[model samples]
Target: MQDLKGKVILISGASSGIGRATAELLASKGAKIIVNFRSNEESATEVVYHIKEMGGEAIAIKADVTIKEEVNAMVEHAINSLGKIDVLVNNAAGGIRQSTFIDASEDLWEETYKLNITSVLLCSQAVLKHMIPKGKGKIINISSTAARIGGAGESIHYAATKGALNTMTIGMSRELIEHGIIVNGVAPGVVETPFHEKFAPNDDRLTRMSASIPIKRIAKPIEIAECIAFLASESSNYILGEIINVSGGR
Candidate 1:
């Protein structure tokens, strides 16, 4: 395990799913964790409670990451509470209420962009104000396999935003590396998370989707969390401008 004994890490949308998994995993490695949630205080507190029980330090902060003002406030709270952030995991992401491409409305597209793309922008900029000055930091963006495959016909808008994020990751990595801030991305495939339950097709379709992958099954949330942990570690110091594919041969 990477020794993150004193590192402070902030993860957005950490009340549940991949975000929650990342928080617990990073904390387990000795990093002080800031778990950011939009509206789920109870869940967020549970995450913090679990971390504390395991002898890790953590605090919960709430913010609607898509909003600039709230993003700034959340960052402020994190800095005040944790002293400094050594890593940022941009993990809060979502799409429109389930819809086929033809049925996806412009409003849905707008909301999805705000959640998936704009939030990354807002959170990154707010946190960079601190990390840039420190002259060294890590940023891990939670993209999706959908970004490369274009959704399963129902999440084109979400896919589009992730694609934009992929581009942004590369551009930002090149731009930020000079400042000693390493920016990278993780694109996860069919993970076993609530996100699939809410956004993907029915269970029968999901079973088939899983069967079709080369691994013949979906990934556990921790599998992706493990990858994020790596990017946040000193082990990845030589890597830059890379968006790793955690897909199960998708």
Candidate 2:
């Protein structure tokens, strides 16, 4: 466990899935959490309630990370409420539907980039103002295996955006490391989350996807959260601009 007592961490899209798990885990390690949810207020509240029930501190804030104004307000609110933000988890992202690259519409491409790529950029920029001043911070982005393999027949746009994030992670780390801010990413494969329920839909599809992995099963949300927790901690201080693949060796 990292000594995160008094540390303030902000997690976007923290209503459920990997974001929620990361928030809870960090809270358990003594970090104060600012849970940012776009629409799922009830779920976000549950996350905060559970954290407090476990004697941890957490607060949920609503914000559409894709919008610059909203992103700015979210960061300001977190700083005002928690005094400072020591870590940022850019975990808010989604795919509309799996489609072939050529068959993908312009709207789908735009929306995918807005939520997955632009949101990360907006959130990182907003938090960098405060982190740079402190001379120490962590920015952990949630990427995907799709980025490397290319989701050609399945969510190619989504995969492209994650690839953009991967590049940004490397670029930002080099730009900010001199200021003591470490930027890294986590690429998860076939995780059991709401994302799969919405995107995959069919149980048989998920089973087949899991069977393809070397581990022969999908990952639990907590598994990915553990990796994010490590990146957010001081233990990863020497690790910068790297994306750790938690892909079950896929």
Candidate 3:
């Protein structure tokens, strides 16, 4: 509906969940998609195959977003394969392993920062070179409500990294607006993604947690994808430096 046709877009962590949903939705609207995955080559290819089945253009590239060199190379591949990236969805993240502060090791905190915060910075920086020259672009970072409402007994380090990301979004938006690049963020709350099945395996606790939300349900992956799509579109031209909460009233 937003006429993303012919636009080139890159999505990290696109093997499954919200990233995968975003890829499918954007591809449906005719954007040339670059699916970035870390280790899930089969799942990544499946996403690409589905996009192509719908007559959409897409390619899957494996890259560890947390690593600067890999992220930079992925950006290059996306640009070379798709021409130029008009929209960059910084959806790559890796802080789902929840651990208490005292229990969290230095390595855990370090890894959280590298994946959740640093990756966003590197990916955005890589894309900005091309984006600025073109004089228009959109960058959407996927954050979490945990960033604001701190997950209890969970990884405080994870929440801290997300908060840092939100801050970076605000700062980057201020600096890049003059360059015609809009930077924004989406903070999702309790989205029902594959991460949950692995992280919260206790059915009883998971059910109780789901019921605790004001909406009494977890968000669908597609819902978050929809918001990402809107932010990446021209419809959000006037919205800048904003972090839209997709938390279902949480």
Candidate 4:
């Protein structure tokens, strides 16, 4: 759809959820994908296999995105294998359990910061080193609507980190656009993904949240993936530094 043929893309946390959807969707459009997973190689390999089975190209790599060395190594490996990365989807984030402001733990804040903020920083910097020299690249950061409403008191720490990502996205676009790299963000409201399964399953959060969303239902990962796909394409060349909200008018 975007003339993604031969475009090499790298997606972090692609073993599942939105990252996996983006990888598969991009691959389906003729883009070669590097699926980065921290530990779930089995799932990552499954994604690669699915893409190949569908006549697309894909590979899986392991990296803890929060660690600079690991992120750098993963990018190096991807560059070595693919020759070049035309796009980067900073989708690695999660492991957040909801808590209130007064009840939030120190570990919660620190871990959330690492997952949402530090990882984006590490991955972007690592990829920018290559993209800046090439004079062209697309970076789509996966943020959340929680950044605006502060998670409605569910996960303030996570929301705070995403707010930072929103800021970083704008700053990055301004600084990097001159180098031919477009940095933007996608903020999803409520999605039906493994993220909810891990963090909101106990209370059937989706059911309750659906009543509040204007769409009256939760979104699928592919819905959000579609937006990422748009930003990854040259079609969005004129659009820069903006965070597109993909929520159901929440």
Candidate 5:
């Protein structure tokens, strides 16, 4: 049988980039999927259509994970439609603005934390009840390389939020392991996603960053998706509280 044939997975930020790619890949493997998006309804619907076209089961759910009520509603909707969620991929994140900590506004910092760290906390909490009852679950947080290698002239706020996520993953894993739930993370490096365009927007900076990678190339969303798939699958049963880097050896 396929590793995830009978599993139900919930993925946040499913409108684009790594989240969208992971949703597609997991759906192809026979997992019933709940594709959650804060905005970009069209893109989320397109993802669902693609999954359905491939003969995969999936549904697009609207939710802003940063909000507790919305996060709860999202999990409720998924459980109502798919029965129960066996996996939760906390992939929703904000883009980084090119500003140093001293120059950054307090609002930007707050927004970054809300989207990055708060969302993970809210979604994870919402899903815990369902997962604990079943006695097994997987939670994968899509973190970033910036959390390890801080960016210059960029949002220290965004990087800090990611670092908080890493800490949260570790702490949550320890707390949840006794319940038979596995918590892990994937910290991706420079990927060719809309995120960079929204932040850096400098073609030259993009080229330089790509060239700096050990592999001399940026990551594709699918490449990160594959790593997330492994963590979410039984193949990584023994690997808990680990953050797998998919940053092309950067």
Candidate 6:
């Protein structure tokens, strides 16, 4: 395990799913966790409580990362409460509904971009202000395999936003690496999370999706969290601007 003692890590949308798992795993490695949740205060509290119960340090903060002002405030709170942020996990994102280009609405497109693409930009910019001064930090984005293979009939808008994010990850890394900040991303395949419950509600459909993967099984939240933790640690210092695929060979 990576020794992250004294490190301060901020994870957005950490109330549950991959974000929550990342927070828990990092806390176990001795990192001070700033759990950012938009609306699930109770779930966020539970995450912090569990971390504390394990003798780890954690605090939950509420913020809508899509808003610039809120993003700035969240970063400020992390710095003030934990001294400084050493790692930022941009895990706050959503795909409200699926629609094809022919049937997609303007509002859906706008909302998808705001949540998946704009939020990443806003959060990274806000945190970079603090990380730049220190001349060192880590930014790990949660991308998706859909970015490569367009979601097509599923969620084309969501796929487009993630594609933009994947490109931004590379661009941001090149822009920030000279300053000692490493930017990378993880593209997870079909994982068993609330995302599937919301997006693919049909059990049979989900089963077919899993069967299509080479592994023939959906990933656990902890599996993706482990990849995020690796990218956040010093072990990935030499791995700048790359997005690792945690997909089950989909």
**lDDT of each prediction vs. the true structure?**
0.92, 0.92, 0.90, 0.91, 0.89, 0.92
Model 2 stretches with alpha carbons more than 4 Å out? none
lDDT tens digits by residue: candidate 2, 1-250: 5777888999999999999999999999999999999999999999999999999999999999999999999999988988999999999999877778878899999989999989999999999999998899999999999999987347889999999999999999999999999999999998889998888888888888988899999999999999998888788888989999998998
State the displacement of the C-alpha of residue 113, model 4, in Å, after optimal TM-score superposition.
0.6
Which residue pairs of candidate 4 clash? none
CA deviation > 4 Å runs, candidate 5: none
Please, what are the lDDT tens digits per residue for candidate 1 over residues 18-50? 999999999999999999998889999999999
- RMSD of candidate 3 to the truth, in angstroms, is 1.2
Tens-place lDDT per residue, model 4, 12-58, is: 99999998899999999889999999889999999999999999999
Q: In terms of TM-score, which candidate is stronger, 2 or 3?
A: 2
Which regions of candidate 4 fall more than 4 Å away from where they truly are? 202-204
Q: Per-residue lDDT of 1-250 in model 6, one digit per residue for the tens? A: 4788899999999999999999999999999999999999999999999999999999999999999999999889888888999999999888879887889999999999999988998999999998898899999999999899997347888889989999999999999998889999999988888987888889888888988899999999999999998988888789988989998999
RMSD of each: 1.0, 1.0, 1.2, 1.2, 1.2, 0.9
State the TM-score for model 2: 0.97
Looking at model 6, the pairs that clash are none
lDDT of 5 by residue, 34-57 (tens): 999887999999999999999999
Residue 180 of model 5 has an lDDT of 95
TM-score of each: 0.97, 0.97, 0.97, 0.97, 0.97, 0.98
Model 3 TM-score (2 dp)? 0.97
* Candidate 4 C-alpha error for residue 26, in Å: 0.4
Indicate whether candidate 1 or candidate 3 has the larger TM-score: 1
| Clash count list over all predictions | 0, 0, 0, 0, 0, 0
